[model samples]
Target chain A: MSEQGYHVAILGATGAVGTRIIEQLENSNINVASLKPLASKHSAGKTVTFNGQTVEIEEATPESFEGIDIVLASAGGAVSKELLPEAVKRGAVCVDNTSAFRMDENVPLVVPEVNADQLKNHHGIIANPNCSTIQMMVALEPIRRKYGLKQIITSTYQAASGSGQAAIDELIEQVKTYVKGEEMSADIMPVKSDKKHFPLAFNLLPQIDVFEEDGYSHEEWKMIHETKKIMKNDMNDTELKVTATCVRVPVVIGHGESVYFEMDNQDVTADDIKELLSHSPGVIVEDNPAEQLYPQPLTAEGKRETFVGRIRPDKENPGAFNMWIVSDNLLKGAAWNTVQIAEELVKRRLIK
Target chain B: MSEQGYHVAILGATGAVGTRIIEQLENSNINVASLKPLASKHSAGKTVTFNGQTVEIEEATPESFEGIDIVLASAGGAVSKELLPEAVKRGAVCVDNTSAFRMDENVPLVVPEVNADQLKNHHGIIANPNCSTIQMMVALEPIRRKYGLKQIITSTYQAASGSGQAAIDELIEQVKTYVKGEEMSADIMPVKSDKKHFPLAFNLLPQIDVFEEDGYSHEEWKMIHETKKIMKNDMNDTELKVTATCVRVPVVIGHGESVYFEMDNQDVTADDIKELLSHSPGVIVEDNPAEQLYPQPLTAEGKRETFVGRIRPDKENPGAFNMWIVSDNLLKGAAWNTVQIAEELVKRRLIK
Candidate 1:
């Protein structure tokens, strides 16, 4: 490996996840020779700090990827659809944080701890799983390897930050209004472009994304599809049954999930599940109930690891179990996952 | 109908839900001969305002029910368990807001919109369903009555107020700390006395109540069990499967749910579901995708009716449908539900 760092470009550099990627890279061991921040025309010319230096955001285009060794894309699906191929075409290895390439046959959707080996088969581009799926997989992968997973049902308590910066601002404003005994207003959040904005400061919103053809919201669909993509290797001829109910809460940063699963084997106890998760990479266990130890979003804010707690066997179903998982949505869910992939690329010598 | 209102007693009169009950009863047409506000010994000397008059808080006791025609109880489960039966024995009709008697076979669980007829069988006590279940049932009951319901899967986005006042205070303090870039402390919420508090200002917490034997939290279990108790015409039939994931969010007031259900009958379109909800009593349908109209917590805050939106069919299951439901947690979820039962008691002329 050369002492000189790799030339890296961050697409969607103005997004919530993009900012985290910059923070992760700032303290990372990876040597960065040059940093390129790219976004839409609206964000072009905006300056972002990287490694203590300001980098001007440029309009993302095919030519912008030339000479870049690794590209981290956190743009939306449409942007990634248009720009990701261009980055790959310019000979840069791409790690996309959008839903565009997650289920693509050629792309490997990876969570470093869960399936770092999948990186070996990536065809120039890798996809990050959905934010909700990423945290669940991080906690469940270790259990799956040890106990063998059969089915998983999860309900997500997602934060406003999962939507974007504007949503976070709206929550703050709404909360202030609530405290001041003033009428609160919400125009963005739980699907901003959606007709009515509800005050999330002191309330909950059930729909996370737009509704698809089926009754499920797009967010719920993402969890269902992304879980399959992440755990694809574990599924044999049988399809992985992943049922999810995704909801948006007043929380601004972290995402929490209540996950229930059935194991192929019944001997695995809740204690065993807790032990496995405690030692799993990038996972923290806080499941002692006597002293009331547990993982919470309040404690998970700004942290990189996924927190697991409340592990117990399902009393009604012999082989079924339940667990709680929490993590900073912007970190492990998006930015940190992308940076971890970048780190793995350096370790595996996948990037020049 | 008596021109003079009955004597009313409010237990846990200063609580989150209790406060809403006072607000609702203020403009109510129900004749009130006298108002008695009862609390614990600690708060016995305190005072709460009711309809422009300062009502002294009296110590809650078995004797407190004397001369009371209707007692609305919102204290903790223990308090309700201890005082409710006493209130009933003393000739006061008890409308309990706690989970104490929800599953008691002798007690008839009521969600007025869904099973107003159940009030006929109440033997001095009527149980209110869980907040999450209440809103979902209100929205789905109309469809279920017409289509013959089969199964339901739901996830809840609950507010801090559901956990009581300490949680609300924690959220406010934490948000202020977060805005100032300072580390915040967590002493309450996501389960008070639980080791390690997380910041609620910008996070999601999956654990609502303490974990039960089958990996489900007590809160989730309540939703599942209460739904059956409220909807089952025959208590012996356990075939009405309802699975729930209950989570606590940073929101302070409204409770939201993402619900999916499959009907015994098919051919029901999302529009049909919307039509059913639109006409349901105590339900307001706001679903319109193109113009971005949908139910949101912010909009639902302070509103008595349950708001339903995002109606769509599940692509995977032909007869299945999905929708979003939101309501003020303190109102319909607790206070309003309790007060409605009291109103029902009068309408039936059940109160002797």
Candidate 2:
């Protein structure tokens, strides 16, 4: 695009995921000529580090993407809905980290390991799948590629960081109150505006995001719909079934999922599934039950790779198998995955 | 037995679940002539209160059950196997909370709400199902009875207390270490004897019990086998498929399960499942998404009833539906279930 490398602007640059995007760029091979960190008016003056240099955040506006080559948007859905379109109109490709455009007919919901080819077809905005769905797709992509996938049933142990910085602070405060034997109070969690707020310290909240009319939370529905869209076309097909229970736990960073999948080939054994995952890209198999090793949130924190473990066959069904999937919610689930898609677009020569 | 009532001896009286058993007995309608609180020699002199009377715990020995009419055993498996047969030999009916006798052909694993009739056929021991399985059986029994049951897939968020008082203490200590920015060290978690231990403070552990020859952990296997033995008469039938992924979370008291089940009757609606559980004996339905009402572990703590919520129909399978089940692990899972069986034995005149 210019004599210098690509000029990258990170929307929501002061937020949890946006900061991780900056850190990833420092280690990544992408040649970022200049970093434009954009945030809300409240965080406009804040400085964030990029490639060991402090970059002052600017108040995000429609015209902020004037000369940007790539826009990594992690601002909430409203900001993305209002500002991302202007970025695209200015000839910038946006890899959004929100649900704003995920289900749009023209946008492709991508997990690079699962559907990087979809990047070639992106109409200016390429949507990143939900964190829980992204890790599950990484673990199952190998198995699904080797043996066709039919249905998926998942239960997630998502971390507090997925809700953002305020929720993580709340968990820390609750833990301090619990340690001091004081009454624990909660102001934000399990849908901050919902009638009730539960502490994520030493507890599990089954509700993530808001509840839908059909009784499934928005997080659960996102997993169901996003997986179908990313892994298969024609999501309305009756043959492909995906269901999930998305829950919030006390973990601060990584998200863990207990995933059960039915394969079309009935004879795939647990060992066979493990072998496939070990060989798959962007997936690390940490399964060794004898030594009590598996993918844990603490172990996966700040890491870019998706970890798969606890591989086992469903004794009741020959076609079904179970595995544990974990990844840093701020990394692969959000920021890292967003950066990966941008890299893919550059690699394919699709981006200017 | 005696003029006052049946003589009840509680094994492992000083432990976490054992203490809750004493509390349940305090409010129970069963008339007690005497309360024999038995524990290891180390805790023999500890005093526990029952029905406003302070009872000293005696060292658990084979002779402790000489005149006991009923035995509520919450001691570890080794202690139960060593001393339970001695109690049975002395003519005391035992409701065991350990896994020692659950799989024995003679010992009927009973969840009173699901299979109280199995109590009559028990020779001496009526085994209590694992905490996770008991709550699931209570919620699903009514649905299973109205519409013939087929298959179940579940993932659990179990509390630290399920592992015992030591694990609870470990969780509390780990949380304190985390709050103070101290390096967290763990010695017992996700199975203490396993070579590696992971902190459960702000994280989740996928392995609950030691892994079997296959990749399934002992806890996962227990859920599968115990559910079949409790719900169906001929567990060998290939049609009854039960699979589970058991995980340990940071919660301290209640265990939560996300269950997906298929029924023979394809016409059962979400309302139909909710209506059945609401009227069921030991289940309390709390599914009102509009009001944000669901069964949370914090709300279910110290409660005797199993709370069911988040009832929704699976769109892919006409007969399949999903529900969230929660209960105090010590109460309904172990201590309360054991006490209920003892009460059932009294009500049926099956003891002595």
Candidate 3:
């Protein structure tokens, strides 16, 4: 850590999220004295532009983080589990964009807007929450602050990009096949490593990630547990119950969520929730049904803000509300969120 | 009204659902001696093949049903409101696939699998429930019968075909635009006559129909109200509270729903639900996680049965469960359902 800005490293620098992290850093106000981009051996020697300078991605290893002050890792959970620890041992404060350390008792899962203060609690690594959970938290945190939240049931319309570059490329190829009247082939959706791969072009995959305990997909487990861990930290009294159904849609970017939530306060109204989110940090409320304005994936693509709309109370349940939340899965859900945490670390001086 | 066969008239025969109704009737075991394919003047004189004979589409007028014993209507809500009553007056029992008579006290909203008994109560017009509602009732009716039902919170992944043939074509056009790297121009989806239109290819439109009371779209309202009407007739004790968030995705056919329900029987397990559905009428259970088997829209397209899968008990809440239900929106949701009602009417000797 230097007074003349910190030495930074972008692990997984040649990947989709890693590439975005570099661009976000260049666009952001983060003053970087030096930048080192690191990826797997296959991606090493490839170059990516950071702050207008082409930085060569080096092979990621234990010594890759020797003099690095801040390390941003998104090379997958296994990579983060192995390399992020080594980086941490080398005196680097890492903000990991994988689930490797999210539920770790020591690592704080931070969505800067909702729980930036938790950065002070990180034990060398601050875990970034899942893409779906991060956006839901960004939109709900504002409302949860004003109206006491008790329960949440969310159904996600996730984009193909959340699976990484290959899935998006497969989706595009599938569309090409669909237009040509050929059967679209699939080897990369729902879960690439799973037994079956279905075509997501103009279709939906209800399963995201492999099946976990009790028939719930691992993606669902992440959403269910991550929400509890992130929310219960700041909240001390009420028990917040959460459930989720994670689905992968055909979109190349932007994840849309249909969230139904119940509040402890019975009198909370849609207008009250909308007005509050409009003023909250990192959230943009676009709800106006009369004009047919609402959050959509295409509109929110590549954006840094979480777009919230369709705020309405459940007609049958008094204290409950339903809303649609959309955000760029790679950006707000991954890169922008990761970058935000890095900025928070600098501002709070939590890192070296 | 003859013993040889009933004369069947397909109002709006040229439409997506209307065409399917004609096909369903041809594929059904119902005895049909003659076929009258009626549509607007625009589609008049268009030829449709039925029962191996070519039939010319006639303009749907009040007099179109004079010699018809049974009429299947799906032109539009307004067309049904104006012409269906006229057909009824002509002594043609009509099964309507529009919203005009669904809630009418005189008309019984029927999904024969769930409420065939209600079909006997229809005063001339039997309303086919909304496509989304039809599939949901088919899956849950069996569950409600065995395990006492209390509440439902559903989020839908609806297809563009639900808006009719034009929207489906628009979605294709939008997909073509997306592949060519051009901005997709959309003017059909969400709702044709609504204030705004958004592209559904590789994207999601949160608004399904025009916004109704409490910011819920008319589509959501239909799912809410129609579900209650069809479910309450069978069971009288428990109040079924239903709420929905209906979204239009890029798919051309099939609608998928994420349903969360609380059963009155606390100990109902996923195996119990899956076992019950496997034997349920007009329902298919495909819930195997290890093989990545579940109800997906692509596989459900063109199928008559409602496919249920991903049945899992809520990990956090006892007595609650989450499931995924998918069915061809045109067939099971509209055409096949209407045809089944026609068959039931004949079987019960209630028609003519």
Candidate 4:
């Protein structure tokens, strides 16, 4: 690796998250000597603008990472599994946006704010946590630091972009069809790999990703396991309980989570938790109910900060409190988080 | 009330729920000799077709209930508070859908499937619980009865129709504006009484009603209080604890809820709970995650039965289980529940 400037390569450069990663790099403070855009063979001929320069994407293969200093991967789970190992073997530090390496014991799942120090433990690959888990960790890490966290029950209102660009296109197209009083069709949503597809236009689907054997969807399990791995580091610890219901709403960008959590300290008030989050990094508190101020998906679409509001102490459980958290699933949840992890690797000089 | 037939007056007949009540009556097995459509003076000239008959709407006043045997009220709370007692004084047994009499000690908050027995004790007014509460009551009453429920943690994804027709129109108009790349204006969502209005087209609003003391929104409080009243007539008994976070989504008709409940009996499996709900009245168990069969708002839009799915035993809490419930907010949540109450009064021969 060169100290003067770094040669960066973006895997899956033509996809939704990959394009956002390139945009994040353009707006970021990272010094770049050169840029390489790589995508699948079908998308290799496409041209994407990075830092106001037209860069042609090449077909992604093992040889593409020859001199790359850092790799930002968002192609999907299959691509990441195939190429991320070769990229790592080629001596490039990869920050993967897919779930391929997130649960790997050797790979550190990093949110930067909560576990930036985990970057020191990366074995050539640092896994970027899921969009939903990353935002929840950002909002909850501050409170969990002050008051010990015991349990979490979360329900997500995720946007179409989390699925891919095609899901967004389908949502917009379905809305157009609905307005025209035509029959709406769905070919990609909830879980594209699954048998049935449901239209998310003006509807709420309770499934995200495929269902697991025990009835929880894969998306829910990701939040459960990823949160545990990112927070505990000790995979066997069962002290912190987590359960999630991941749902897809009609929004296009941001994701909203209704989180109910119980703290070890029963005396912690909502104001106390609010004050802690207000001072935490990469977190914004928008909880003023009297003036009707709260975090909303539209207002938080392009923002990199996790917006939290509607803080209320649960009356039923003594140590429990409820809050509404919103963040751009593409930005803070995926792209920016990946970029932040890269920045941490640079700040700590963790890249080999 | 005569055994042959009954004269029914539908308050707020030109509104969303009011119109649905008329439709339900037309399709119901209950004998209706006469139908009186009543609304504000503005809607007096409007005509509504009931059972294929074009009926003219009249201004709702105390005199409108002179010959009315049952008054189905869905107007705003203020109108219900002012005119409902007047209608009751004219010997009409009123099933009010507004929150005007819900918290009144003498008024019975009845979800017919759960608390139709309490309808006999109503002093001229039977309170139809909030739309969110009605669906939750239908889904949970079965479980509570079979397993002995102890606690409830619910998060609602409510539809536009829950707020009335203007909110539904605003949601559609906002979607159209968003599609046209124009600035979307919202004058009726989240809370029209509040100073600020956020677009519900591609966003979610955390606050359904105005904020109450202790940081819970008014809509959340209604779910908390109304559930207690319908489930347990004795409010002093604090055995059942209910907490809620109500959110308004972009869906046009149905309301979806993610519910986590702890049962008094710890040995009940997820299948046991599902089987319990499958046999319960007015409940439809749609829980087959392996086949991608689950309850969704789009699928539950026009259905009268409350759909329950995604039943999973909680790994953290021994006695707890999580489930998803959805139903048409306009149908089962308001109009259907109100009409069912009237049918109960008819069956019991309590109206005079």
Q: Sort by DockQ, best first: what order?
A: 4, 2, 3, 1
Per-prediction TM-score, please? 0.86, 0.98, 0.98, 0.98
Docking class of 1: acceptable
What's the lDDT for residue A262 in model 3?
Answer: 94
For residues B292-311, what per-residue lDDT tens digits would candidate 1 score against the true structure? Answer: 56676667878889998877
- Single out the weakest 10-residue window by summed lDDT for candidate 3 chain B: B232-241
RMSD (Cα, Å) of model 2: 1.2
- For B1-352, candidate 2 gives per-residue lDDT tens digits of 7998989999999899999998998889789999999999999888999888898999999999999999999999999999999999999999999999999989989988889998889989989999999999999878888998888999999999999999999999998888888988899997887888889888879989899988888999999988888877444686778989888998898998999899999998998888787889999999998887888888899899999998998888889988889999999999999999988989999997
Provide per-model DockQ scores. Answer: 0.42, 0.80, 0.74, 0.84
Error of 4 at B142 (Å): 1.4
lDDT of 1 by residue, A200-271 (tens): 676666677886655567888888777777787432324456667777777777888878777888888777
Could you give candidate 3's per-residue lDDT for residues B1-352 as a string of tens digits?
Answer: 7878989999889889988998899899998889999989999989999989999999989988898899999999999999988998989999999999898888999888988998788789999999999999999999999987888999999998999999988999888888899988888777888777788888889888899857889999889888888887322333777889999998999999999999999998899898899999999999989888999999998899999999998766788999999999999999999999999999998996
Candidate achieving higher DockQ, 1 or 4: 4
Which window of 10 residues has the lowest lDDT sum in candidate 1 chain A?
A233-242
Candidate 2: docking tier: medium
Residue-by-residue lDDT tens digits, candidate 3, A1-352: 7878889999988778998999888877788989999988998898988767887889999999999999999999999999998999999999999999998989999999998988899889999999999999999987788888888999999999999999989999999999899998999887888888899998888899999867989999899888888887322333787889999988889999999999989998788888899999999999889999899999998899999998998766789988999999999999999999999999998887
Q: What is the lDDT of residue B294 in candidate 3?
A: 92
True contacts kept of 2: 0.80
> Compared with the real two-chain complex, what DockQ does model 3 have?
0.74
For model 2 chain B, the run of ten residues with the poorest summed lDDT: B231-240
Where model 3 places Cα greater than 4 Å from the true spot, the runs are A233-238, B233-238
Q: Which has the greatest DockQ?
A: 4
